[model samples]
Target: MIMVNRFSRLIGTLIDRAAALQHIASQCILCAAPGQKGLDLCLPCQLDLPALTQCCQQCALPLFDHKAYCGQCLLSTPAYQRVEAPWLYQPPIAQLISRFKYSRQYSIGKVLSNIAARRYASAYIDQKLPDLIVPIPLHWSRQTIRGFNQSEHLARYYSHHFNIPMKRFLKRCRPTAAQQMLTADQRRSNMKGAFQMCGDVAGKLVAVVDDVMTTGTTVSEASQCLLKAGATEVHIWCLARTE
Candidate 1:
């Protein structure tokens, strides 16, 4: 029995290594050039990604000036303290995200998660890191249909990279219509009471991880739930933000 277990573990490690080597040799997903530096993205294409050059410091929305908050945020502040998104949701980045979320492209998801993790580290190197990372949960039905939650996957990457703990502390108690199809007011209405706290977060700084931030309604609702559960602060981290 011991011998068999050892052989099985060895086989699993070999398989993982082989897969990693194959991925390193694969062609670039964007330009179809040969792989370079063990990544699917070539150097030029990687540089050309739709980075969020200028954004409101509070909400991470694209901004024309160096304002801390956008006009809407000034009117009414969001529950979360700040949002950090590395890219604007547009063009090739949007297409890649769609493939990762809807098309079951796990490789693309891994690439995106890696990029987001690097960006998060650089952005917060001089600042206070969150005590815990919480992924924006999906309803059980949605999770069953999708096989996995993209937000959870991103959270795992951040957890591994930053050595921070992650918890599925938020639960989606009710499933609502897709936020993309609704107006801002409708989105807010749809998300009301949609999230519930599954674990105590009292006096802790938590970061909510999600794939994208559109109107910020979903994260706001989730943040409100966390705060109501006694969390001291909540921050939003996402791959992209739609302007």
Candidate 2:
């Protein structure tokens, strides 16, 4: 029985390792070079991706001054207490996001989610993890066309990696115009009252997940909804941010 148990454990380990390798891309998605460290991107390409090293604590806008918060954030803090985005909305990363979002490229989305999971793990090393993960919802009309919400896909990855529960707690109250097409001021107004909280988040620390944050109006509106629903604190997490 002891020998049989040992054999079983060894087989399980081998199977797990094999499954992991199967998921690792054999060629880089961008350069067709060998994939790096199980990612679909080569090391050179990965290093070339825009990283948001310094940014506002509240908004994740790239920072130039040696200050913790940006001038805009200092002037008027956002509703969410914090925001984290690992990459800037630039080439390669931007292209990858476009493919993942519009082209329905699951492989690209997997790579993006993996990158986010790694960064977020280190980011909260000394901070408390949120009590719940919430994905920004798509209105049913739009979701019917897209077939999936990209934010929900990323949120699921975070929940699994961090061993935290994820909930679709917010509902898109109305289908708003595409944010990218609107001016900054128009974008802010477009997201107004766009989200409604559907669950009891009273006193809970909630992390809201999205694909990209441009003017941050969408996330701000979502955060406001959660806060009004009694959430103690709200944090925004996204794959990329536009500086």
Each prediction's number of clashing residue pairs: 0, 0
Off by over 4 Å in 2: 1-25
Candidate 2 local lDDT, 1-243, one digit each (tens): 999999999999999888678556456888988887667778788888899888887799888886898888889889999888999998978999999988889889888898898998899999999999999999999999998999999999999989999999999999999987899899988888999878899999999999998888999999999999999999998999898
Q: How big is the positional error of residue 148 in model 1, measured in Å on the Cα after superposition?
A: 1.3
Please provide, for model 1 over 3-73, each residue's C-alpha lDDT reduced to its tens digit, 9 standing for 90 to 100: 99999999999999998887668667788886555567777877888999798878899997878679998
In candidate 2, position 121 carries an lDDT of: 85
Q: How close is candidate 1 to the true structure, as a TM-score?
A: 0.89
Q: Which regions of candidate 1 are displaced past 4 Å?
A: 1-26
| lDDT of model 2, residue 100 | 92
Residue 97, candidate 2: alpha-carbon lDDT: 93
lDDT of 2: 0.90
Which candidate should be chosen as best, given TM-score against the real structure?
2
